[model samples]
Target: MTELAIGHVTTDCAHAADLAGFYAALLDRSVDPGATEFFATVGRESGAHPVLMFIQVPDRTAGKNSIHLDLHAPDVAAEVARAIGLGAKHVADFAEYGAVWTTLADPEGNLFDIGTGQA
Candidate 1:
């Protein structure tokens, strides 16, 4: 057996609650009530295995993120539009590896990619 499994991805923000709400809306998940002011988690009701956690920090300096998420969706265009409507800003759209994808930034300027699950 593997010693490790995939865990949640964490994001640092000035306002953990706000960022958690943003992601909750975008991902169609709910913010877990166990979260505190400085930490929030977006998790599914069925299970708490995979989650996105937000941690509040005193200062949030602007800089390019070295790591980002790549989400796979059945309809990339629709998902991108929905994310934009939920406050994500569109960055770019491109095709690579026989797949089409769009880049977007969250409210706090965290960049993520949405792509059609094609190869």
Candidate 2:
């Protein structure tokens, strides 16, 4: 038998370094020093899996991705505001099933969600 685990969540963008930097600032994680303009990663300090990797794709698809990230914050409003300040665009907000979530697009237009409740 073999065991597997998720390692990285990679995104394709026009500028890898820029996208990686934006996420690094948003997550308070540092971009790996060995990063290059074509490829970059913002890694976790305590573990190896779940590193956020960005790769340059000059003609990458523009719009919401099929798989989007979901984030949780103590205060959804404030976090969404902060994400906007970091270059994210607020797309919309939804409330259902006793949970409310805000949709936002990253600089390159990759949509993600943020909510107060567990997703």
Candidate 3:
């Protein structure tokens, strides 16, 4: 048996609610408001155990993120475009193991990768 399981992934951003809303719309999930206006959660209503949480921070620096999310989609191109429409910026496209993936950054400049569901 696995000794540990993920609880949740927390993202620090300038605007917690806005970041949470962006992910909620992208994932087709909903945001659960936190105790204060500075925090919020995405994917709570999806019945998923590990959700995404957004926390408000004062400063947002510009640099490559040490950690990022990797998402899988049935239609890679369409999903990447949809995320772009939701304010994500396209970084690049890459291929590995005969599969294609796209890199993108959220409004706050957090990086994440999206891949076609292929082996």
- The prediction achieving the highest lDDT against the true structure is 2
Report model 3's TM-score to 2 decimal places.
Answer: 0.87
Each prediction's TM-score versus the true structure: 0.88, 0.89, 0.87
Better structure of 1 and 2 per TM-score: 2
**Model 1 C-alpha lDDT per residue in residues 44-70, reported as the tens digit of each score:** 444766678899988766788988888
| Candidate 2 collision pairs | none
**Total clashes, candidate 1?**
0
Report lDDT (Cα) of residue 113, candidate 3: 89
Estimate the Cα RMSD of every predicted model relative to the unseen true structure: 1.9, 1.8, 2.0
Q: Who is ahead in TM-score, 2 or 3?
A: 2
Model 3 ranges off by over 4 Å: 1-3, 34-37
Q: Please give the lDDT score for candidate 2.
A: 0.87
What is the C-alpha local distance difference test score of each model? Answer: 0.86, 0.87, 0.86
The order of the candidates by TM-score, greatest first, is 2, 1, 3
Clash number for candidate 2? 0
Q: Note the clash tally of each candidate.
A: 0, 0, 0
